[model samples]
Target: MPDEVRELAGVPVLVCDPDGPLVATEQDALDLIGAAFLGAQVVAVPANRLPEGFFSLGTRFAGDVMQKFVNYRLRLAVIGDISERLARSPALRALVHESNRADHVWFLPDLDALDARLRAAS
Candidate 1:
């Protein structure tokens, strides 16, 4: 991840999938978000496979990530199939919808669409 950041001549747009378990805490989420924002415009994390106990902590982390992005005015996009999340949490789904309505946070279905959105933003 560090190497990818260093290799970028300009801001990069990171594409990632949540293949492993979801993060456990706000700090961990922040760390990953920070890593992604390093020389990057967006970070795409998979929609499924989030931590089993992600309700409260995940919400907090999402809030933190939003604050960080607002503070720095950085852009980010979370891409993948979010049906699982929607099925589990209506609140989270609402949040995703609202975020996507904004200019910064986006919930897309695939990397290609994400890339298109980022390019459009730029």
Candidate 2:
């Protein structure tokens, strides 16, 4: 399936396919933002769609990609379980925790969680 937009808790979200193109570069992240610009207020990217470097804080790839979304005023929800990765890196765990506490970025376990969050926000 391709990346498509869906309404979750009254918010239009661009839900990316789990098997879609890898978001390993800044340009790739920008493309997603552009796609969401059509109508989505949020972009929900599957964890598998991201490169390994994104989960590694030392690489700073995740930070850069997240900054792009924030710059564009779009909420980003990274969907899928990342417990393994989180266990491997404390910095990443902290990042996820902090991101989830804000409205701009979120690391969710699934679409259901994203729906719940949006519902609460509304």
Candidate 3:
């Protein structure tokens, strides 16, 4: 399935397909940002679509990608379970916790969680 835009809680969101291209580099993230520019106020990416390095804080992949979203004034929601990654790194756990507290970046467990968050915000 292709990535498409949908309205969640009255918010225009670009929901990426799980089988879509891997977001392994900054350029790849830029592609998503570009897509969001078309209409979406928020971008929802499946956790599986991201590479392992993205979950590693030391790699700075997550930070850089998230910074792009923030810089572009677009919200990003990483949807899907990251329990194993969080379990292995306290730093990642902290990052996820902090990101979730803000409106710009979110690490949600699923699409339903993203919907709920959007609804709450609305």
User: What's the TM-score of every candidate structure?
Assistant: 0.67, 0.98, 0.98
Scored by lDDT, model 2 comes in at 0.96
lDDT of 1 by residue, 8-101 (tens): 2243765554565465566655665677665665655555534545433354766765566666666656657767767888888888788887
Candidate rank order under lDDT: 2, 3, 1
- Give the worst 10-residue stretch by lDDT in candidate 1: 1-10
Which one wins on lDDT? 2
Candidate 1: the clashing residue pairs are none
**Which residue ranges in model 2 land beyond 4 Å of their true spot?**
none
Off by over 4 Å in 3: none
